[model samples]
Target chain A: MTLGEQLTETSDALLELILAAEDIEQKEKLREQFDVITESIEKLVKENVKKNSKEYIAVTHNLNAANQSIKEAIDDLDKIAATIMQVAKVVEMLGKMAAAMP
Target chain B: MIKKITVLTLSLIISGCGLSVTQREAATRFASASTSVGDFSAKEFAAMRDVTIQMNTKDIALGGKAKINDLDGAFDVDDVAIRINAAIALSAYGDLLLALVDDRQSRDLRNATMQFEDSLRGVSGRTLSDADLDNLGALVYNIGGFFLEQQRAKALKQIVLRSKTDVDHLCDLLIQDFNPTGLNLLHAVDNTSKRLKVDADMALAAHKDNPKSKLFAIQAYRLADSQRTRVKKTGAQAIAVLTALKSANAELVNALENNSEFLVDTRLLGVKMKNLGLALKVFSGS
Candidate 1:
């Protein structure tokens, strides 16, 4: 591979190895850079016509999921807590009234 | 009158709804068990001890030269001596024995007493048969250091070994071996996995952008995930049971958020609670 192509592969590989990157937009920028380099090289090699397809699809899916799941988990935790308190309020009123009768 | 009832009802509702797993258990137990250790008193503890002392003294009397059988229940051998001799077991037999040396008591003093009584317990409890006692008697009467040299050291070693055995048995009683509420043990694994995952995340956050540390964090995350996968799913049928418990005792005026966990679970308490009911399964700490 040419020096530019090697540098591109190294960057993409480094990017893939990082887990749960907090900023998906930052990752996408780095990823798009890697893709441009890969697209240029594959055209030169006359490799598969679907050059940047596989990795391009994966990074897109990951970027979307990471952005979505973090917010979802936080919201889900809050919802579970709110439901618990609501249940508690209902039961407490019923039980206390029953407990107090002559 | 209705206003008073409404306030009381509301207060109970808050307590019932907010009580934690441990306190709830204690409340249930308080409703059921006896008020105190009426039968587990010092005298009863002492009598069981007298039987032990009797056997020890009996050995000393029978073995040959001097027949000293004047071993009445003279347990006034000092209170500290009593505590050591009680040798209160943790789980029948455990590997690590916790000695109760009161803060006021000196370390050497407690150790000396523990070693002495532990020897007495071992000799009386095992190995020294009638014939052995007859021989031991001759040695105790005629020889100096007979109690300390052979009997005491042999007994200490034996007691230490027994204490180790006790610790092992107690460790086996760790509640997580089986699910706290069922035949399955997944609850323990779930709690463990969650704690590990949190720790891994914290470690990763601390390490931040370093590649090596991040790799370690990824490995830690995988380990935590593996721990989670080891557990099967939980069944929430017990939630109703807990709900029923909350309803039953959910009355009272004060709402305490801090001690909520202590309020909900069924546990054996070492000492009685400051306030109690008629039924509780108050288990000793040991």
Candidate 2:
């Protein structure tokens, strides 16, 4: 995939992570990590990072390689996602118990 | 040969006079930029404090029900404290610059500048000689064209150097505190999010076993979700503010660095002061 395609895919994944985040704490953590990556991108852009720059080429190449394996990695996350939803359900149930108490 | 020497000396003196004009313009530009940095820093810190207060309030309310600890205390207090300190330093520095340039109408400013200078000397452990002090007083009192050439240059250079040092120190202090405060804010937001998630999960579990309590469980989950979203949005804004502040600090430092126009003009002023010294020596046959 091209660099633009990879970035688009990365952005989608990040959005999913943010939406699925269990609480504001988790969302903040995810955003902070995202900020670090974006800050680096900003610096590179400011420096006029050229297409021929070895680092840029290497990063795009590595990301493309990593993209192939991400589907399997996401499959693993499904199990964790199920567990989190279950926990959320349990917390909702407890809130009912507390409200019903004297 | 005598005529040639006389002409050369006259040209040097004329060039030396021109240096004072150049130095005054450059010093004015530097002071204006430095004031902007101070104003920007103060405004950013105040904004940070406001955001921190909002987050802290949410955290406190959440902590009453959840297992979250308060991580925003330090930031909530230090933000205002640091901003006030920066304002005072900037004001004193501005007063000193004005006292040097403005006429006798700035009498109160002159006294304020003297007090600030004394405080700075106490801190830096540097003593001005009696003659140097007299020259400075003369410069402050004789606002317009009534000063010796070398004394005026010396006083201007001294004031510029002191103002530069003060602004640089303030910037250093701001930069030093910024990173840790940003991190603390992030941590507080993160913890609050986590605690809300756990609370929502517990409420969900209780609702599973108690059908009559379904409404309560739904309300609890909704509240937690909304609070979490609010904290996340605010935390993101705080991060952006900090990023802008860091950039401002870097720009201020760059303007004051040795290669910048401000410092180059200052060096030119030093050269002019030296030329005046040489003229005095030649005329006095010393």
lDDT leader: 2
Model 1, position A93: C-alpha lDDT score: 41
Best by TM-score: 2
Candidate 2 per-residue C-alpha lDDT over A3-99 given as tens digits, one digit per residue, 9 for 90 to 100: 4234334543554575577666676666565544433333333232221123323333432333233323333333433443344345334434544
Of the true interface contacts, what fraction does each candidate have? 0.00, 0.00
Estimate the lDDT of model 2.
Answer: 0.41
For candidate 2, give the docking quality class from DockQ: incorrect
In CAPRI terms, model 1 is classed as incorrect
Give the B-chain TM-score of model 1. 0.22
lDDT of 1 by residue, B1-286 (tens): 4344444544544443433334334433422321122112222334423432443242232221112442322222443132222222221111111111011112322343334333333442343344443333222222222211222223223333323322222122211122222211223233333333443544566567778866765665565465344332111212222222223222200112234443332233322222221111121110
Tens-digit lDDT track for model 2 on B127-184? 4544443444333323312222333344445444434433444444443333222223
